[model samples]
Target: MERKNHIILSILAILLAFSFQESRAESRDSLFFEWYTTTNMEPWKSTMEQMAAERTPDNYNQLFEVVLAWYGYIGYCLGNDKEEEAEQYLETGWKFLDELIEMNPTNAAPHALKSGFYGFEMALARYKALILGPRSVSTLKTAASIDSTNIHYLVEKGNQMYYMPSMLGGDKEIALHHYKHAVELMISDSRYHQRHWFYLNTLVTLGYSYQSTEHIKEARKTYQKIQRIAPNFKWFNEEVWPKFVEKYGTF
Candidate 1:
């Protein structure tokens, strides 16, 4: 009888422990979702760190990927000129992602993120032509090998083709092809698959490509599309419109 009672107690203890663990897991998952949705990256970083402390290396790879996604979000903040906070987040997030990639070389997401990282870094850099040329193409080609269907990859490749110097093999027609392909992929979604910012970027890139190739009417139409979507996005006024007018508007 005593032996049977001991067995019952052990089973109960195991069940209780499992229940506690499940509750903790749910709490962490909820916190992660909340931080992600609200763009509360600092708190999200802390939560990921705590989770990393208890997780094994294999699981930590995925956790680190989530952290890297925040890097992209924080990059958006940087676009808004939130430089100080963005720098801090970018530094930490880049380190975490680098480590994760070093540990797991086969993962497709890190390769994709690297393509984005190099692309953005060069796009915003001072000497963009000299610096961002080869690295961006190489990383993006790797990402393409891993996930060809990814719309961002297609768009980025298209952007490079449209804007890169002749020696770098920039082709305006190829760029338009990729942009159209991206649009096709997103067309079936209930919400435009290219969200507001992405759509804005696409229009700007397309307009510049067309303008570069001396297609003035096409450039005007694309810029008009952006105006319709966001009458006040800063890029529209300062970057796109000015360039469009300088190149194609009635002079």
Candidate 2:
């Protein structure tokens, strides 16, 4: 009786361990799915780490495309200082985007991603915009048309609207409306990080818009709120405000 009882306890312990491991694995997978959908690449770095561990030839090409896209985006966010890395990933991302577009010309995702890549390149190298603005604008329009149901595509369009001229139908009011719509649609997603990022970006955009229209007090409040929320935020402190100061020279 004593020996049988001991054996049962040992089996229970083993089962518990297996269950815990499986639960952790599922949690990780869920996290990655959220990141991939929301375009949040920071914490999703672990997914790339896992891909590196299982670098099979059959999966390598797809993995490379994703990695390039993520890195390209990350470097883009890092601002003008990382120009070299940004350019490298921009090139890599375009190649992959082109391949994906060729494979499925009507697929909305590739066009959306391509539009973003071009926009990032324009931010990093202003001259690129002079050359590629028309192409990027066309691609973004196609992306929105192709994926009328995806809020992400709409949000991408909203972002493009901010930079485009009035002749191109880029209206700040329309952009704000769409940004609010995106936040409403995606806020309840289990992806907290992605939601958080969207919130932050929206805040920044709103703040800048207020500043642009001479709402100095409102912009100052927004900037102060950003500092309070993310005191060490990379772009907010370093790149964004400096550019603002340079442009208005007293704001």
Candidate 3:
């Protein structure tokens, strides 16, 4: 009787672990969609740690998404002053990214993602910027050179260009060129259908790039385009655009 009870308890624990993993797997696609669409972290609040803890090098692209998702979530945490949480995500994200690049040494996308992660590290520890800043730029440029036409690479490069200060080599004009080329690539390519997360994400950044450069008219037009395509994008619709309207008044 005692032996049977012990076996039963062990089996139950194993089953519970498997169930948790399966649940995370089932929710991956939906949570990803919501992350970029709703831009709300509510669904992801409890999953970041689980996702990172389970990170494996088996599927290169799968691990890539985990790290990228971490990057996104970490950004939100940093912006909201959740320093401790952001640091945890940042450490795990960088570790996974390193593992990814080790396995896929020449992969451009991972390198691009690495560059972005470096930015997050710099944000959390400004003292590290001196070393990480140039590394960030070079890693991204290497990614772009490896695959100039990749929309993801272009968008990330543009992000670096658009957000970094001019003193640090960020130029809004150059960023615009990268963004316009990305938009053109996305439009002409059939792989990214309308409302695809990357598709919409590219446009969102392009809109912000326009705003940063004081091209209000172009920004408004971009906003209208997003409204037409992804009217329910809660991040832009509920938060970003409304704030823009409050400051600039709607077009």
For residue 28, give model 3's deviation from the true position in Å: 4.0
CA lDDT, candidate 1, residue 88: 64
- Deviating ranges (above 4 Å) for candidate 3: 1-27, 45-57, 187-198, 246-249
Residue 245, candidate 3: C-alpha displacement in angstroms: 3.0
The global C-alpha lDDT for each of the candidates, from Candidate 1 onward, is 0.64, 0.63, 0.79
Give the C-alpha miss distance for residue 31 in model 3, angstroms: 3.3
Residue-by-residue lDDT tens digits, candidate 1, 188-210: 64323333334445556777777
Candidate 3 local lDDT, 71-168, one digit each (tens): 77787888789989899878778888898888887778888888888888888899999899899888988887788777767877888888888887
Per-prediction CA RMSD (Å) = 8.3, 8.1, 8.0
TM-scores of all candidate predictions against the true structure:
0.55, 0.58, 0.77
Pick by TM-score: which candidate is best? 3
**Residue pairs with backbone overlap in model 2:** none
Candidate 2 versus truth, CA RMSD in Å, comes to 8.1
Query: How far does residue 203 in candidate 2 sit from its true spot (Å)?
Result: 4.4
C-alpha lDDT (0 to 100) for residue 31 of candidate 3: 58
TM-score between candidate 2 and the true structure: 0.58
